[model samples]
Structure formats: structure tokens, C-alpha cells
Target: MRIALGERASGGSARDQVYLALREAIISAELEPGRRLSENELAELLGVSRTPVREALVRLRDERLVAIVPQLGTFVTLISTEGVADAAFVREALECAAIRLAAQRAGEDALAELQANLAAQDRAQAAGDAEAFDGLDEALHRSLCELSGHEIAWDLSRRANGHLDRVRRLSLPEPGYLGEMVAEHRQVVAAVAAGDPDRAEEALRHHLRMVLSGLGHIRAAHPDFFEEPAD
Candidate 1:
């Protein structure tokens, strides 16, 4: 599959830029699961040398977003159910713990910011702006993690989220999915606003697990995007 590479952003090393670009393409399914990758072609497309392209692929390999096969070539990895579950587990653990701390510490202004984000999510959903909703979704989660005074919760969760994100991107087109997500976010935000740590954690946990609930449906809809069962 052909992909139009976006222009390089200002700042950051070429390797980091290339890594972010390739990683985004993979997560967005622009590169696509199991698509063959050519280092030379990628380098040419990105207007960089093969060195940065190879380095970026190595990083993606570490993230399990791509695999390098000997005597064959590099190809995007098929979505792994095991990988998705692992990511969910990590995300739930970190974010649940973070939400508890956030509930205890969040001030009115912080809560208002979160509520505003939810409002933005609603507007994005109403406008049929999936990309906008996606960003607001991320912003809401990051705000919760930051409120815990440990932003690394989000960083770690995101690093482990490549496969899970593909499933999320695919699920976006499902009817009422965005509305359901906004309602769940309201529950979590309400709990946090009430300063009830236990309730907040529970609500957030439920919301996070809800993401996994759609996985089976998504895999069925895009069977070719996932890994085949082992013999």
C-alpha cells in the first residue's frame, strides 16, 4: 500500500522524527499491517538517508510495530491479541493508580479543565470530527495522568499502546462509539470531581476496560489486520 509521507516537523533529530512519523503511520494503519517496507524507498520518501530510516525501524521493532525478517525484508507486524491484552493491562494498572491520586489532589480548576475537555469531545463527536475527538480523548487521559504528578504513566501507557491503538482507530467508525465514550468519561470525571478516590478509580477502570470490549468486534471486521492463530 502506498502512503503519502508528511513533511518533517521542525526540531528533533532525524532519527526521532523518522521514528515518530513511521510509528504514527503504523498506528494509524497508513502503513498497514503486514505491508512490506523498503528502507531505500522510505528514506527516499522521507527525504533522509537510509541510516535514519534503519534506526527508526529498529525502534519500531522494539515496540513490536514492525518485524525484520532475515533474507526477506521488513514488514509491519500483524496485530497481536496477546500484545493488545498486555497493553490494556499495563494501561489499566497505571491509569487506575494515577486516577486515584488525581482524585485526591485535583482542584476545581483542574476539574473544570477536564469538564471542558469533555465538552470539546462532545462537540467533536457532534461535528463528526473523529480526529478531533481522538485528540481530545488523549488530552483527557493525559490530564488525569498529569494530575497524579507522574506524567510518565501516560508515556509508559502510550509506549505500550501501538497494537491497542490500531484497534481503537478501527473502532472509531462504529455507530455510537464516540457517544458512549463521552458518557463514560463523564462518569469518571464526576467521580474525580467529587474527590472520591475509590469511585474515581472504579469509574476509570471500567472506562478503560470498555476499550477492550470492542476488540473482538474490531478483529472480526478486520480479520486480515490481525495475526493468524497458531497451528
Candidate 2:
């Protein structure tokens, strides 16, 4: 949402550009849940016409990142516990499978790269740079799928984990949470380096499930940002 539309989005597919910008803002909590949005306002913010903004809104609505109410307005969708659980399940499966293959095919070079990523994660944790830490998390996961020689799996995994991203972002505020995540990541990388597929898979599963396991605590602390499961 903070994109300077005139400067950045003037050349590319304006609708796709708008969509990515708004999606990043939503994921990063720049556009908080239940926040009101309007095509007119977004168009003005991005310095573009309303057409592309309207297109972008439609895509976001389909992703359930935004909700449209007739005669009311558009707003960011509140995090739903059920949706987070579902995304977490799919992400776990994909990542576990991917890590297994990575352990099989990974060479010394790939293992070394993962170690380098862990070193960066350590630095991010020490600096309290959650954004950098999260970025490194993605890099580490993507590196696993990349080593599997199935780049498309990483893309699919990313798309499937969309809902979980919101939950993960919320957990970043918890005390010592990021450091705990870094430790789990280190364990996974060490297992992969050992060439032990079963160990690697278990470690990856545990690492990825942290978001789901911590969901309750986050929901308790930020009740207004989430909708409870239907009885």
C-alpha cells in the first residue's frame, strides 16, 4: 500500500503491481486486519487510476485477504483459526516432503549454503531484526525445495501458506519466539547436513508447526485481530 505508484508501478502490469504491493502490506501488518479500504483511496495512494486498483481488489477478495460487503466497504479479512490450521497442515506436508528430497540430493555445497543462512539467522536474532529473520526463514525453506530440483513445489508451498503468514507475523511479537524459531531451523539444517532424511523431515515438520502450536497464545493476546472458530 505504500508503493509510490507513479514511480514504481508505471511500467509493469499495473494491476499485478498493485496486487503485490497491497499483499505485502497486508502480510507485513502495514494494513491491519479489519482496516477499511476503498478503491478510490487505494487509487489515490498508489497515484494510479481506479481500474487497476479495482482489479487488484478482486484478486485479494478471491484470496480471502479482503472482504467486500455490499453498501458497506472493503476491509482486510480477520485471521481465522480454521484457515490458519488448514494452511499450516498443507505447508507442513509440502515442506517435509521437500526437505526429504533435499536431504537426498543435497551436496556439500548446498549444505554449506544452508549453514551460511543459519549464520545470518543468528545475526538477525542477535540484532532483534525480525524482518531479516523472517526473510532468512523463507530463504532457508526455499533453499530446501530448490535442492529438491522441484522449484514448482516451493511456489505451490508459498501460495498454500498465505493464511499462515498472518499467524506467523503475529507470533513475532512473542518473547523469545524468534530465537526459538532460529534454534529449530538450526536443528533442521544440521539434520540435512548429516544426510539423514528421516531426521531432516522430523526437524522440518517440528520447525514448520511452530506457527500452529503458538496460534492459541497469539489469538488470546490479539483477540480483535482474529475471528473465533464457529461452533
Candidate 3:
């Protein structure tokens, strides 16, 4: 399959370009889990040298997105259940704290921004624009974290939640899941607007728990797409 380089090569180094392209591919699931990635092939496809491709692969390996097999080749790393579970646990804890702070700190404008994001999400769902909904979902969550004034916490949450990015997109394909997610966001907004820290934390936790549960169901249904622990 021919890979399309969406943008023209800029003045940046080839390694940077390769890194950005490969990262995008992984995040969009264009590069399937466990798929082999040949250095020569990717270098040729990206019109870059093998050196840059190798560097990019090393960076991706560090991020746990790619694994190198001795004398064999490089392949996309299958996200392990244990890794996903750990990420979800950390994200839930941090986000719960974030929402609690937002309940106390979010001003009217912040609340309005969240409401606008919800409206956009509703429109995306109604129009069956899964991609747009995903973008809006991330934006809403980031906005909430920013409003809470927990910049460090937000950074940590974003990093930990990276593994779930594609999984969330998959979950959106399930029927009524998007609508339910929107409804959950509404509950969170209501709690935040009312300045009820306890309610906001509870709502946020419930939402994340549902998310983790949905991911578990997906993992069960698509064993090929997910990692299986060695016996």
C-alpha cells in the first residue's frame, strides 16, 4: 500500500518529518497494531534517508508505540491491557482532581466554553462525524483541565491518556455510545456550574470508568487488534 505524505517536506530535518508522520499514522490507526514497519520501505515512501527513519523509529520505541525485534524488523507495538489499565487509572485520578478544582474555579466563561463544546459534540454525533467528535472531545477535556488551573496535572493526564486516543475513536463506532458520552459530559458540566465539587468528581470518575469498561469490551471483541498476555 502506498502511503501518502499529506504535506510537502518543509525546512525541518527528515527525522522530524518522519516522526510527525509516523506518530500521526499511529494515532489515527492508519498503522495497525503489530504491523511490521520496514526501515527501508518507510524511508523510500517518505522520500527520506534511512538514518532519519531509524531515528524516528527509536523515538517511537521509546514512547512504547514501536518495538524492535533483533535481526528481524520493527513493528507497531500492540497496546497491552496492563498498560491501558494503568494509564486509565492514573488519568481517572488526575481528572477527578481536575474536575473538583474546576467546580470551584471555573468562571462563567469557562462554563460557557464547555457548553459550546457540548453543542459541537451533539452536532458531530447527529451528523455522524466521528472524527470531528473525537477532536471536540479532546478539546473539551483539555479546556476543563485548563480552567481548573492545573497545568501540570493536565500535562500528565494528556500523556497518560495518549494510549486511549485510538481506542476512543473505535468506541465511537459503537451505536449510541457517542450520545451517551455527550450526556455524561452534560452531567459533568451541570455539576461544575453548580460549584459542587463532590458531584463533579463523581461524574468525572463515572465517565472514565465507563470509558475503561468500553475499552475492555473492545479488547474482548477484537483480540487481533489488542495484545494478549503470554501464558
Top candidate on TM-score is: 1
Q: lDDT values of the candidates?
A: 0.90, 0.84, 0.81
Predicted structure 3, TM vs. truth? 0.85
Name the candidate, 1 or 2, with the larger TM-score value.
Answer: 1
The candidate 2 region of ten consecutive residues with least summed lDDT is: 1-10
Q: Against the hidden true structure, what lDDT does model 1 obtain? A: 0.90
lDDT of 3 at 178: 91
lDDT string, candidate 1, 1-231, tens digits: 443344533468888888988987898798999999999999888888999899999999998999999999999999999999999999999999999999999998999999899999999999988878887998899999999999999999989988888889888879999999999999999999999999999999999888699888998999999998767
Report the C-alpha displacement of residue 129, candidate 3, in angstroms: 0.8
Report how far residue 184 has shifted in candidate 1, in Å.
Answer: 0.8
Once superposed on the true structure, which residue ranges of model 2 sit more than 4 Å away at CA?
Answer: 1-13
Q: Which stretches of candidate 1 lie over 4 Å from their true place?
A: 1-11
Residues 16-84, model 2: lDDT tens digits:
789877876777778889999988888898877999888888888877788989999899999877778
lDDT (C-alpha) at residue 138 in model 1: 84
Report clash pairs, candidate 1: none
lDDT score of model 3?
0.81
